[model samples]
Target: MGLRSHEQLVVCVGVMFLLTVCITAFFFLPSGGADLYFREENTVHVRDAFIREELRRKEQEELRKKAEEAIPIPIPKPEIGAADDAEGRRIFVKQMIKFSWDGYRKYAWGENELRPNSRSGHSSSIFGYGKTGATIIDAIDTLYIVGLKEEYKDAREWISHFDFKEAAKGDLSVFETNIRFTGGLLSAYALTGDKMFLKKAEEVATVLLPAFDTPSGIPYSLIDLQTGRAKTYSWASGKAILSEYGSIQLEFDYLSNLTGNPVFAEKANKIRDVLTSMEKPEGLYPIYISMDNPPRWGQHLFSMGAMADSWYEYLLKQWISTGKTDDRTKREYEEAMFAMEKRMLFKSEPSNLWYFAKMNGNRVEHSFEHLACFCGGMAVLHSMNEPNRTISEHYLTLGKEIGHTCHESYSRSTTGIGPESFQFTSSIEAKTERRQDSYYILRPEVVETWFYLWRATKDEKYRQWAWDHVQNLEKYAKVNFFEPFLNSSPSYFQGAAGYSGIRNVYDSAPEQDDVQQSFLFAELFKYLYLIFSDDSVLSLDQWVFNTEAHPFRIRRP
Candidate 1:
């Protein structure tokens, strides 16, 4: 009410000091002083975005977990069952070789009689399918997996009788000795851990490289081993290109790891580069291509069901092992695989399965009457990472269906079926349009398909299927039960009782279990045993082939 001049002056000075401090603080702050405050606000925005990303990742992890845990697959018992399958396969293989040897001995009785070709097991001379160039290679592949010490030495000696160098020079279109001996040599090395096997495998891979000399960078099916020249255009001419190509790469991959050989890696890449350029429109590849004329060969839009699986498998394996690939290659390959998966794997018959097709634009033109052995191979592709679980499951289901139906209808669920220790379950398809005529003679590939599917799904149904098949084999087919299953004692070895030719040997009503079992028999049964035996998939992670002899030694998580 009656402030003195000194009091009023004090209050005014206090207010003035407060205003001065605020002004000084605002002015001396950094140039982006407003932004500095706003930066704190930006964290709110970032937190929101980060939250969203985490949510998405969580969903993905859930999906992965669901995929991993989905369907409750039974772990395979590879170690325990491996010996059994290996033992069975070994017995079968021994019988096969002995039968051939006996035939060889018998041919001595006739004047100038030639033995069946050792490779293909085809001996037209004895009403046999004629010697196939691929037979010996397959046998050797199996032999390496299951051969005993003495057996391996004998195999080496027998193979030594043929001069592979000269045989490689003779014919290019027909199966060459190089691929044959390469498999044989590699198997030998794997079995014996010997240097000679490695040397021979390398030699074969070196000779096989010239096969990729085409303009398209895709390999020719046949190559002059002597001249390194390209040969004719057979259906599988270009298809055989990758097996040798990838096989060599696998060899090189092993060599690089084992011996630290940079040259082997370099050689593998050289072959890989040639094959890489064959990626075609819509990411699909051609079955045949001329090395010199990439554009001309490119026009023929042919894609076989089996060969397509081979291509994807090779690429996926390479990507997984070498990590040399990029996102683009994987994306392209995945797209191609999805496209093929939808067309061939889904819409194809529940009964007959996929027909070989031509990819014209987005559509396919059906060509073949019989399903090739590759449909089973296609089902195995489901083991990859992908979004569409239904697609993979559907194909796997269809494959099982085919196997079951075939077993019931064609083979009559017979056991111990196979010719010459091999099942001649050829791709049963008819030349005629009728279903009855559709039963063509071939080897039993369904057994292989079933085993692989069982491995992937680990469903009890597959195990039951396998169990039933095993029992059926023991029941109907010519099995020498007298030969004990155990391998520990010499008493288990029984004098060979199984015939080499197909079963239905002397019967008017023949079954499918007869004729020939391919080298793939070991692969089939090995997986079957592993699937049923409560083995872990992690055990098989490091294994490439998962065959009878090499049990999965990799540890599981």
Candidate 2:
């Protein structure tokens, strides 16, 4: 009662601080026997709560890791002033893509391909009998890479509404659909970080899954998307084509990685198990394989061409794509390559050019398809990743020799475009024997090899070779279609014509095939553009290209 007001306030603050300390000690710093007894009684509940909290934290962390894994590493855009004429050449290729895309948009719009000469749209059997816009799907990733924002945006809008369930009627080639549609969408998602493309890719893949429901898990060549029923090509005699089934793994495995779904990879891995278990004669797989529980080689013929090329291509690429953790793929790829070097590799007389010949039984056929020209690029790419210096050197040499031989196929031709197939007999070197083999379908293998070689070696000649192809394409393959519909476009676009295949590369003035294939935009122009781009853009270390030239990001462990 006699104390001043200030002294009374200080006394109250001291009492409150002491009370708070006493309360904290009572809950958290037990010391008395009675307090220890109460703590023991509740220990079980406390431990359980702590464990639950830890588990929840771990679950969150795992989800975070998966989300990070799904995020695509952005591809580097081409620098403005790259060395030498690289920027200029890249621009030329970009212009070519624009020209081709414009023609497709104007004529085909939503069709599979453009008949440039006829100025109309056409659908191929590979895509079934409907307007699935195969060209548009194939060109989306290309458009994004070349900075064609408006075109890419338009394609994305169409893709947003594309229904695989109602894509087409009758049989669709599982291989072609996987490569063009699934692969294209996957690559677009990888480059653009767009979930729309990924969703569409999963839809197509799910529809195609029934194709793998075979006794051997080897996919059928064709599947009716509507019916979900699959069957081998009638011409295949109820057997699966090696390339068709084998080439799909890259797409499916990649889909699984992006979606965190293991089923897609399991189905694809089953195909690998079947092929790996089957006995390959002379360590070489046949073009046709049985679809039984234990599959058998359907033919004695062996080739690195049309029916079998991409099988080997995928084997090597799958290993690389999976962050090189797939030792089985690497082993199989190495074994196949060793066998190919021993049995298929040959040198033509006089000209002394290297090539891979086909094998029928024990007989070696001195024949090569333009389709096999991709082997050179495959070799070079494999060499870069190889651990053995000697093997790597050998592959590099082999790649260059093969590249030169393929270039000869074009240089020897009158129109500077290679034919479908060629021979390497005593009298002939890179010359076609059959009239049917002389036609050029605007194939990209030769230029694809040049692009790979250039990237691997930085040799100027590869650039020159690719440039030569561009010049020839501009000269002979260009289709100048003038119509009132195109008048609204710029003056430069009027001169920028759509490209078509030639009836004969041997013709000084080759007749146009009238059709512009989807691959012209997908593989050909894309490869040409990449050839002139900086190495940092889509560097080989960070990505793996599927057989269709659609690049997938490397999935790291």
Candidate 3:
């Protein structure tokens, strides 16, 4: 019995040992295996999260570096008057810009232009086919300068998705696209330090490069942005206009500098070399030049009004753009000014109003275009660089006289707005007799001159003249909400009203031309803002304005 009891106790002990082993296996071994698997999986996820964070941090640092590099040199703000009305004037201009932009946003939106009278959008041939957002591109810098943050942000977003390749249709004007798009983009980059604008500018400029594929390296007036095939306008007699090709250097050169690309500078410099090498008739460039292997002048026409205006303006501006180091450009500009003073510059009979007349051979046309009014500002700008006090004083005098004459053209008009073209005849001082020359297309040249004159001389008259022009524009050019019935149904026009061109600046009740040019935003409003603000806003010392009034940073030596 004792033996059986001992065997029973041993069996019980064995069973207890087996149960303990089972519990250890179930609770410890499987849990260890599961922990190993989960630890490995968690490590991978943590590594992935860490890598993503590192990449995001690196991207942010790169953007910060780019912004630092793009910041403009510190400019000392000028001391304004103690009780200056400049702020008041600036506010007025800002409101005008906002008004114009609001109208465009509501009615035109992505289209090239605004039909203010009709309260609709109109795409012109110059902006290619369809809606290219030309107005938006042109006004982006203006919006930024005026501190319209919301409007500026909207513009930037639209530009981020803008596809130039798709925007291309039919033929695009190389000059127009360069000045309004590429120039505008470059200006925005200079102002905002945003790389998106630089990218877009380079893209558009690449598309435009093929236009300079001619034997003489002279760019065609018009180019198919898609096909890259280029040709001159039929009206130009298969020759490129001087203003079209010559005016592109500022944009291209600025682009080349920004991107560190030699190609753009080479193309632009080639145009300059050709112009500098060519023999000028009476030291004045013709309005048209052929695109031949050895280019030839097209016509004997020389005018500072239309075909030949910006070319001369660019010569001086290019010098300033390159840190005033391009002595050749300066010399060429001086020679042209001397020749113009001798040949084209004249004074009207009784009023003695100074004007730059058109020259066909040796004969003077005795006519002035509102477009040529920009020459007054050009003269004022150049006078600052002239070393000779006598010549500088003469340029200043000429600039003031030109500014005065342009103001007279506006003040003498029945509507207090200048005509497209006016004559300096024995009887007529600044009146357009021809019906074709009677319209005013919201031009900024006259006021552009006033802005320059105001900056240079600080004469209250210049500001007053600009204010007068603005008042006239508001009274006559601003499209009235009641005018929707002039073209479309009132229900179709539900947005803000925009400024329209007057059929006749001389007519008290002139017909609306129903078009708002992109330049109204790019040039007129911009100039108005600059003239009213302190010179430090976009000081002439640190910046050079393109022909389109888009300011670019001057390369400092």
Prediction 2 global C-alpha lDDT: 0.87
TM-score of each: 0.56, 0.83, 0.83
Q: Can you write out model 1's per-residue Cα lDDT over 242-268, one digit (the tens) per residue?
A: 333333444445445544557666766
Per residue, candidate 2 scores C-alpha lDDT tens digits across 1-557 of 58899999999999999999988766765566566778886897899999999997786666555554664423332433332487787887787788778778877798899998887898878888978999988999999999999999999999999997796788999999999999999999999899999999999888888888888899898989878889988988999988888898899999998999888999989989888888888898888888888888887988999899999999999999989999999999999999999998998899999999998888888888999999999999999999999989988998999999999999989998899999987778998867788999889999999988998999999998888888888889988753222222233122234899999999899899988999988899999999999998899999899988999999887
All models, RMSD in angstroms = 32.2, 27.0, 19.2
Per residue, candidate 3 scores C-alpha lDDT tens digits across 135-246 of 9999999999999999999999999999986877899999999999999999999999999999999999999888889999999988897677889998888998989889
User: For each predicted model, how many residue pairs clash, with residues at least 3 apart or on different chains?
Assistant: 35, 0, 0
Q: Which lDDT value does model 3 have at 160?
A: 98
Q: After superposition, how far is residue 488 of candidate 2 from its true place, in Å?
A: 13
Off by over 4 Å in 2: 1-84, 483-497
Cα shift from native, residue 205, model 3 (Å): 0.6
Give the TM-score comparing model 1 with the true structure, all chains together: 0.56
Better of 1 and 2 by TM-score: 2
**Candidate 1 deviant stretches above 4 angstroms:** 1-137, 147-149, 159-163, 173-180, 226-229, 234-279, 293-301, 304-309, 320-332, 348-378, 381-444, 460-539, 546-557
